[model samples]
Target: MGSELEMGKRPPENAGNTTQVQNTPPNTHILGSVSTQTVDLFNPPSNACCFCWCCCCSCSCLTVRSAKDKRILMTVSEKQEDVDTNKMPQLTLEEVHAWGESFERLIKSAQGRVHFRQFLKTEFSEENLMFWLNCEDLKKETNKTMVEQTVKQIYEDYVSVLSPKEVSLDSRVREVINRNMLEPSSCTFDEAQQQIYTLMQRDSYPRYMNSSMYADLIQSFEQLNES
Candidate 1:
């Protein structure tokens, strides 16, 4: 078959005999013959559309793995990129709860709920799906490291701006934080609300309210209260 799509110099006759180069689509230059057996430009395999595939392959290097694993890696990597760029998905109350349950199973940490919740601020879309996957990776790669890192970052970045004043709180807020610290995953809505109300006294409630530890505390309290 004639190489109608050929746009560059021909591949050397021996290109495939020794070198198995998987070139990309745009500006692809084959150093050997374009045979039927010659592999198509290594477009990453994806469930996503052509735009996503092209975007992924163009931006990222395919991993070194079995062809199947390579495809999986490329798909996952590109999916993550797309999710990061796209809006997050939306869910009804039931769907959100289901999603949370899935997260609880997969993430297995208080911080995971925090990460997933943070992601929910954006619209529910392919992008958020990818982000959820990435957060899972982050959870896996760093374990509790992310929490300490966040704590350190907050300490470094925000601490400098504020006077060395301790974060004053009403006893209720202190009690909530203390309870969560002891239980690690137990804080309920009423208890948490009391904490928040107490924090309002010091204007420190909102600052720590969105924290995963706080969320975990609330969640733990809820779970325990439910139990």
Candidate 2:
């Protein structure tokens, strides 16, 4: 009973205030006067690392998977062993004495080869003996593919000028290797092997014979035998 009022839809309480329509995307909600973003932890962004919760950079988990792919892509035969050693069996007095008789005898003995290699290392000529040993292993290969791979590895290690362990070889032997490279067989390195063998026999073998390394081994063996 104040004055007669117009009978119409009542004005919204907020009519006096500006009604703002928030342009929020889907899955968003307004709570009170604050807007908070919610993330679907189940579906993270592309750059996010699943391995580490806080890490966003390219991570080791992804790199390890890539390494696994590379390993799988390589043939089992072509892959080198991750760990290897040149260790030989324990030496014996008989083996030590035989080393003095002839270079061939020394080369045939595992223990002798180990000691001789140590001697050659001091002379910076170990590659000659290493080349000879690799050829021995190469000659044992029956598979054509294995022969080819082994040949290439030996060439890279001992025949190539770029190699730190490149062995000495005459022009004739080198030319022969270059010529036979196209169709390699187990005996592809025979000439190179023989050249290195002869080189070791003539030069390094005598020096190794006179070295205290050989003398000490012989003395230790004799002493051990006496004990």
Q: Pick the candidate with the highest lDDT.
A: 2
Query: Candidate 2 residues 56-151, lDDT tens each?
Result: 245555333334433432433233212122243444566678888999998997656756766665665666777787788778889775676566
lDDT at residue 9 of model 2 (Cα atoms): 21
**TM-scores across all candidates?**
0.18, 0.61
Relative to the true structure, candidate 1 has a C-alpha RMSD (angstroms) of: 25.5
Give, for candidate 2, the lowest lDDT window spanning 10 residues. 39-48
lDDT of each: 0.30, 0.57
- Clash counts per candidate, in order, are 19, 0
Residue-wise C-alpha lDDT for candidate 1, range 1-227, written one tens digit per residue: 13211112223332222213343445322212221222221113222221222113343333322454444344333433422211223212233234334333323433333333333222121222233343344334332433333222222211112322122224554455444333222121234333322323222223224444334433533442353
